[model samples]
Target: MQDEDFLRRPAAPQPYSLTPAILYLSSDAVHATHKLLQRAGRNESCVFWYGERHGDNASVHSIRAPVQRSRRGNYHVEPESMSEMVRDLRAAWRPLAQIHSHPGVEVEHSRYDDAMVSSRRILSIVFPYYGRPIANWPSDIGVHEWQLNYWHMLSSADAMARVRLREFADVEVRDFR
Candidate 1:
């Protein structure tokens, strides 16, 4: 399979809904971090993150980093800023993954994103298409999956792809075989 196949998944025909409980019930710090990453994305209408990863057993809470942008409504983060974030993460004994959002933007991973993630785990959260009815984590060149409207995670490594969605409640898992 091609690299694109590694990031692609079948899309559902409808939108899924995520309940608050589902978002609050994660036992994995990584999973909780992902949820907090989502809120930080929506909170700033831009992007936010912990600047570092967390300890395996630490609770994913009270971690946030605000991104700076120009007055022209353009977002920008410098190399110095990233270095500082990593420094802070090191101080807090956290992981090296950075989470941020692409609010009101459909652009895929850009050169800048590549540059940032090149040295760390970069998680990009693209917000609502505003009114666009596209699938969650939808992309013509990437992965797309359904979670009964809760969460979607797409990954591609070594031409191997995995797409999985976690539901907000108990739901049937369809077997297409």
Candidate 2:
């Protein structure tokens, strides 16, 4: 499927929004993410950094946590591993977001996700797997951000507008792989 196909997919009944506004990702990062999620099968999880946050825009850099086996529909990051990743990334770049895949499910934040969000300002992305081929991975990418004591799910258009409200209307998704 094409990139536009992702937007055309039906929206889930959850809130999603890009907290700061804009988000950027490298083609390499996107490709690797697809591969990682595919290898993870359904319900498995992987974690990554949204790179450095610059004002209302951020870039997705690399995978901090590789795909790991877990129970159906659940994946947990070890506390120690998470702390180490945060420490290492914070030395140079802050952890801006975390991306995970929902195998055979729509992209939405589960209660588990909300509970795990902690108090940090981070963008949580859910990629729809739905048992589709890897080429069709991320068929629908859900973007969510915690704000006003809730996780708001923003449509693609809304996300773009939010990111562009204060800056230029033209938002670019550059691949610096």
Candidate 1 residue spans exceeding 4 A from truth:
1-48, 51-59, 70-74, 83-92, 103-107, 129-177
Q: Indicate the TM-score of model 1.
A: 0.35
Instruction: Give per-residue CA lDDT, model 1, range 91-117, as digits (tens).
Output: 544332234344344334433443334
Cα error, candidate 1, residue 82 (Å): 3.9
Instruction: Point out the worst 10-residue segment of candidate 2 by lDDT.
Output: 168-177
Q: Could you tell me the lDDT of residue 67 within candidate 1?
A: 43
Best by TM-score: 2
Task: For candidate 2, write residues 39-95 as lDDT tens digits.
Answer: 555555656654667777766654555324444466666666566555544444666
**Pairs that collide, model 2:** 15-152, 15-153, 16-152, 16-153, 16-154, 17-154, 104-130
Backbone clashes, candidate 1: 7
Candidate number achieving the greatest lDDT relative to the actual structure: 2
Q: Which stretches of candidate 2 lie over 4 Å from their true place?
A: 1-20, 66-69, 130-139, 160-177
